[model samples]
Target: MFTHRIDSATYLKLLEVQDSEKLFQLIDSSREHLRNWLPWVDKNTTVEDSRQFIQHTLDQFAAGNGFNAGIWYQGALAGVIGFHKIDWQNSTTSIGYWLGEDYTGNGIMQKAVSKCLDYAFLELRLNRVEIRSAIGNVRSRRIPEKLGFTLEGTIRQAEKLVYGYVNHNVYGMLLEEWEAKENSSTYDDETYE
Candidate 1:
């Protein structure tokens, strides 16, 4: 089921078939806002599409490759965050995330990401994690930066959105660095609950 509570009002839950309608509604309402950065927004036009997406994430979890989860805030589905895929050989993975327009500016994504990092390092014992953001997506870039990831570099035209190709700014954090930061900071105990 994979639920991690971030606070009294927010948590991350693994998407399920029953969540399809809510997920689709949120995406439909946030279409214009999300379309700017998310390439699959246009393709996800129905509850069926969302169901298929959730099924795929469930399969990913089962395969032990990675996972995608819905960001539930104040009892509503606000967005999604997940590891694109894990490179077990290299002990590395890249995260991808997005928030609905109404859910921004509350530090929700940052907290969710921190919890995922805890899971990656302490639970999974992964060595490194990365987050790649479109160059112009300031909000997305801010999450990893606030969490103390180092700016690795930019990959030119790394992804193709509906409009065109976009450059991606890569941010990376090593497990050692995360451990040091956690030791020095006031991190909470709400991980993998």
Candidate 2:
């Protein structure tokens, strides 16, 4: 039960084999919404597929790499947030996330991402955090931008969606910058704790 509360009404729980069914349900229901930007959506056709994903994440966690954690909103599985990879030598990591259509517009991801950034910097001692969203994805891109990340530039055709390839807008935040933001009172660690 890898659980971390983001706030009074939200949390992130590690998805495991037992969670495959519920995870599948969420993905199945959000297929159309996710398929637009996520190419792997169609590949997740069954509970077993989700189980494998959970197992992989668990392995990643055990290896001290990074993890894919499920977002819970109001006690329900809402979506996922994960570090795609953690480059230990470089002390850097990249993150990705999504929320169900029904759970959007509640600032759920903003808070969730803040906590993850805190963990990356404080616990993992990562030097930088990167977030990349498909071009034109205003909602996804806004998360990093609002959090004070610098837009590094666009990677043309960085990801392949079901429909076609899409450009990605990359944003990056350094540990020093995060500390500066913390010192400036833009984000209070106590509030997240």
Per-candidate RMSD vs. true structure?
A: 3.6, 3.3
Model 2 agreement with the true structure over 57-114: per-residue lDDT tens digits = 9999888889999999888999999898899999999999988877877788888898
After TM-score superposition, the amount by which residue 61's alpha carbon in candidate 2 deviates from its true location, in angstroms, is: 0.8
Report the poorest 10 consecutive residues by lDDT, candidate 1.
184-193
TM-scores of all predicted structures: 0.94, 0.93
Q: Model 1, range 76-112, lDDT digits (tens) per residue?
A: 9999999989999999999989888898877788889
Q: Which residue pairs of candidate 2 clash?
A: none
What C-alpha lDDT does candidate 2 achieve relative to the native structure?
A: 0.87
Best by lDDT: 1
Highest TM-score: which candidate? 1
Indicate the TM-score of model 1: 0.94
Error of 1 at 176 (Å): 0.1
